[model samples]
Target: MTMQVRGSKLAARLTASMAALALLGTGAVALAQNWSTTVVASDNGHKVGNPKAKTKLVEFMSYTCSHCADFAREGDAAIKLAYLPKGDVSYEIRHLLRDPFDLTAALLTQCGDPKKFMGNHNAIILSQEDWFEKGRKTTRAQQARWQFGSNGARRQAIASDLGFYELMENRGYTRAQLDKCLIDEAKANALAEASQADVEKYGLTGTPSFVMNGALLDGVHNWAALRPVLDKQR
Candidate 1:
């Protein structure tokens, strides 16, 4: 009877040790892999997550639109935390250049390398309230420079008056580099044309729109609505 009891106690200890080892192995696997930090750039935008993800989500957002900013605030945390780490889904925020304000912000976001796009993007979008208010207070004379003159001159005027220059400067960009990006007629025109194409292609009615798996996710604008659709795809 004593021998049987001792053997039972030893078996229990071994079983517990094996389970703990299994759990540690699983944790190591989880810690070793997370694809959320990856980002790739396309001509008109930056993409995040696995390049060949089964589910691709595209957001058509304009810097001038408040709703787009709201999405950035809400959707970013949810998607980056929950979905992007999985490596099965991808996200891209495509530009919708509505006006010079939109174009200026987009140019600033696209200023540095591809890796800088999202950080620059959030910087501009999150601070829209301040610069937009400044724009509203500007005199007609001040606003005129944004609309009239050469393309580079008009872009420069808008950037200066709206505080975009200061925003990018805070993001570690030099004045000369920001100016070069802001005045690139070719890049600006390409952005404009791409936005136009997306608008027509999607039959989009507003600034905050979505495309999922190459199909437009109709009537889904905010994060709340977007969540269910992404879950279903997963």
Candidate 2:
């Protein structure tokens, strides 16, 4: 399918998924105690909490995905404040690229230092509506930029003309620095390859999917449904 067709289908699926998750009710209550900590980039994700933690939780997410954004808004603090402090569970976020916009956002997030990845990730997700709106308004000439040139050129065009560069700039990134990141062909290709492998390996159908201890989670996509599963692991 064409990129436009694929993006439309993905957006429809994401909206439906977000609606379903919303009906699941509010998320689990916050933990009484909280701790300050940081997460680092790993092989396929940003790793947070103890590496040796017995229960490993991974989230396969796309930046353009509304459900993934919801999870970030609803469940992120709980994970960091409640679970990470316990030191028995570790959380990692693996990107599941859904489109050019998702690819751009993923690259920009990775451009930051590993220690700042999650912070940048959260900032992007939290402001999803703003940048995604800008993306949808991209002119035909801007859209065509993706079809030609080196991967770096394509990324730079998307980031510069599509408003992603401005978005990152507001987050403290310089235009020169972001331009270099857009050209990092290795990082971009590795991310895409990894996401493709996940699609085939897990038979993924949507974003915000979950895995526990190396197994794809079944029948539990939202944080409300996922909390109990993590509790069992703990």
Candidate 3:
């Protein structure tokens, strides 16, 4: 009798484990299916094109990436011409962990009025080549080797390279805010956590990637290639 009861309990435990696994798998599928182009943030966050447009496009970019800059300068013109002006699509840009300097630049961009978000985005993209000429490269591997390796040193370097740190000085953020943005333990943890979430959720592995109304588009292709799809959605 004792042996039979133990076997029954063991079978029940196995069944419970299998049920839990099934639920986990179902949750992951739901998350993937629900992956959205919209980033719900207070204060409008960083957006472009039409705010109330029917379609939503989200861009994952890094300020330090030349390819991303190319997309911003060359590709954006066509994007703006088509989706932005038509009130058919709303655009959003989010940052993934490309490098530490990218974080510093992001902090600077987010420092001022959220109204000028795109302005700051353009400023960084436009200056990409110039900054590279002056020996500031914003590549993923390069950033990891240099910036994340030493947060304090990288912060000071960016304070000199970009006026972002200084701009926030008068904004009532003590040294703590500046350092917190650069080395804030929580923010750093959050970036890492969010990055992993983005990767698994979106199957994204690089920058300059886009999701146009839930359609995933990756690469450096021109807007000519993008219009047909955008048009169909319209």
| Top candidate when judged by TM-score against the true structure | 1
lDDT tens digits, residue span 108-212, model 2? 988868877887888788888887787788888988998799878888887776577777888788999998888888888899999999889888888899988
Per-prediction TM-score, please?
Answer: 0.87, 0.80, 0.62
Tell me which of candidates 1 and 2 scores higher on lDDT: 1
Pairs of colliding residues, candidate 1 = none
Q: For candidate 1, what is the TM-score?
A: 0.87
Of 1 and 2, which scores higher on TM-score?
Answer: 1
Model 2 segments beyond 4 Å from truth?
1-36
For candidate 3, write residues 22-53 as lDDT tens digits. 99999887655311233233221377655667
Cα shift from native, residue 216, model 1 (Å): 0.5
Query: How many clashes in each structure?
Result: 0, 0, 0
lDDT: worst 10-residue window of model 2: 27-36
Candidate 1 vs candidate 3, lDDT winner:
1
lDDT of each: 0.89, 0.82, 0.64
Q: Return the lDDT, model 3, position 27.
A: 88
Model 3: residues with Cα > 4 Å off, grouped in runs? 1-45, 49-52, 136-153, 162-188, 218-222
